[model samples]
Target: MIELSFAGWFQCRLATDPDPYDEPRGVSGYVHAYAGEPDLDRIVSFQPPPFRRTHGRDIGVAVDAVAHEGIAVPDHPLVGATVDLLDAPKFEGRNGVVADDGLEPLYPFHLQVARDDFRAARAVVPADPSFPYAELFAGGVEFGAAEIRKATGEQDLTATWAARVTALRAELADAAEPLRTAIAERLAFLTGNLGADGGGAARFFGALMRYDYVLSSEPEIDDPHGWLDATDHDEPWRASFWLGGWDADVLCGYARGTLRLPDGAGPRRSPRVPRVTDRRP
Candidate 1:
């Protein structure tokens, strides 16, 4: 006597007993792909006594039945039936979530099934391009160091740093209005704190390049300072100060109409001016 179980998101059952179990079984293994459909009636016919019954079946049901039989059921209507166990894809850490494909960096949700299973299943396309992270960065606001590396052999650190700064400046010049101003101000603050001489700029730029890639990709990210903490730098307070200045400049830009708001986002309220505190000696 062979016992089989079919388990997944879809509901299904195959049992030799006349009265099949009411509850669905828990998913035990990763999803798999099979060559052909299972013949429920033929499979039930093979079983002794009460005979098996299939209810709300899926591909998993056929795979489970084939595994139990231990031999191919060639005579059944569905021919060349075979189960092909699929391998899982590689997942890398992005933002705070683990994802396989290069989806929106800020999308925190993920779904995984075997390759073969996915190919056989229906493909669902998202209606909006910025789903999952749409509400977070609706304005498409993105900033951080731009790519300024040249693969022209090895060069002196000072020369390399100068070239990078020049490239960054050129990129900023092409940016739209106040966004350019916001980025330029932030970059100046960062470089000034790190210092231009004594390899400080080079060290900071290296860290900035890596960190900025992650930051720019994740448009929905809320805490810029938090992400900047991942950079390889001893003075984390620099990042905090830089982010504060960047946010202030961006908000002011929006208020001044130099920067445009996201679609459907109403006009921004005027930024509150800080009151000067009087101190007497």
Candidate 2:
């Protein structure tokens, strides 16, 4: 279980394929969660961070996870975090290998490739399951390249590396102070990527982190599974606006609330998560 070392963050995506997500009893959104912040600049050195803000778009990969992370397992009682994470992305940019589907990605769902465990996010259960998954609003990017260095194994513990890590930690400490206070004023923290909203045992987030790309999402979510009850196999809904390649950010939107599926793994075989070659952050 790879966890985050920096402050809280979330990664969101849009809901392009609703048949796999929409449901009668409940409909949930997906959010890939990760620790440490991303250096979109260093990662994509040629291209600077987007001057304009973006919300992620819907992803379609087969929707076969959700039960492994010890969360609600969908179709169960709609509780716990309000968002989710999966491993899949269809690139459509000029440089993207996947053809354009005409879906305008609101955020940077560019196709991040970290380790194999790439589907970590928070979810919520709204009063009505049919509603669209809401997107958390964020303020500004609070993490930097140095903070990531501290969190990942990249932190050099050697005399020289230790000095750099020390300096980086100090910088993160100072930077995280205001950010932490800001979150304390509005958000809650949790162990896994499953953040919760402020109400009861369930976790949600007021803000989230965005990733340039994701490694885990739905596989062939549109297909119905026989292992679970028919009632649990409601059509899927939609989730948009999330993630920044592992970095934390302040949220700025809120639409979808939450929903549920069932407690079955189905016959869908899990595929290999995407690998981000030589990621800098």
Candidate 3:
């Protein structure tokens, strides 16, 4: 199986046992790409850390050099499929709660790639050209950063972040109009009114990780890497295994108007203020 990566988070089980958390039993397939890397080498899934072991509990799979399966981008919704692994696989063993207890070998686990419905994800699109516009979003992010810098009295660090934002804007200059526009508009909304009630300064940074592109704000949080892909409801976004930098737990409260921004060291602790999940309630 080829190690695959993508823009947003994607995780699924071949088995449809109905329990969302249970591992699928008996299935195998090869992945072609990951995060858009066509020449991926290995596909490995590590079990969660044991109470004693901090790292390196790799589950073995039967993968061929040639990719047998292709994972679509967020544009191509991943359809459920069945695959046959070359060999009986070994799962990283754990003690309890697991349906099989990791004792009964579950090979060829049914794999169904799942993700958040693109409709809500599509909310990031910039529908109106007037409402704070995309440029304003960028400006808001800049302004928020400036405020942080002022608070910390770190003129040099602020200057450095400003330059990084400038370069990011330049890089974004080449992106598709819709993507660029949407990012700008949403970001502006997020960073619009800092220390204000409605502005989503915290939310914008939270959703930042979902983006196909990487942005730099702080020295510790700077990553300028990502791709611009067309939107597709069927495709998987990011791998489920990929952890987010921000706290999603706070997003629901923030969106519901129940949470407040943190005092100092705001961005890191208050990662995402917007809930990616549907808020229809």
Best by TM-score: 2
Any idea what lDDT model 2 has? Answer: 0.25
lDDT of 1 by residue, 1-281 (tens): 11111111111122111222111221221111111222222111111112211111122212222111234333322122221212211111222232212221212211111222121111112224443232111111233223212211223434533454566577777777555664465456335634646554233222211101111111221222231222222111100001100111011000000011122223434422223111111
C-alpha local distance difference test of each model:
0.23, 0.25, 0.23
Give candidate 3's error at residue 157 in angstroms: 14
- Alpha-carbon RMSD to native, per candidate: 30.7, 19.1, 25.0
Candidate 1 local Cα displacement, residue 157, angstroms: 3.9
Candidate 1 ranges with C-alpha deviation above 4 Å = 1-153, 171-174, 189-197, 204-281
- Across residues 1-281, which tens digit of lDDT does each residue of candidate 2 receive? 11111111232222222212212111232221112322122111111123212221112112323342244355422112223232222121221121122221222222221222232232223222342111212222333334334323233212222233344444444556544443232222211222333322122222223322222333222223223233222322223322222322221122221122233336533322223221111
- Give per-residue CA lDDT, model 3, range 1-281, as digits (tens): 12223222111112112322223322221111211212221111222111111111122111111121333333323221111112222221112222232121122222222223211111122223232112111101112334333322333422333443454466566867655664454233223333347432233322211112111111111112211122222322221111121111111100000001121221233123222211111
Off-target runs (Cα >4 Å) in candidate 3 are 1-168, 193-281
Task: Give the Cα error of residue 47 in candidate 1, in Å.
Answer: 52
Against the correct fold, how does model 1 do in TM-score?
A: 0.18
Report the CA-based lDDT of candidate 3 relative to the real structure. 0.23
TM-score of each: 0.18, 0.21, 0.18
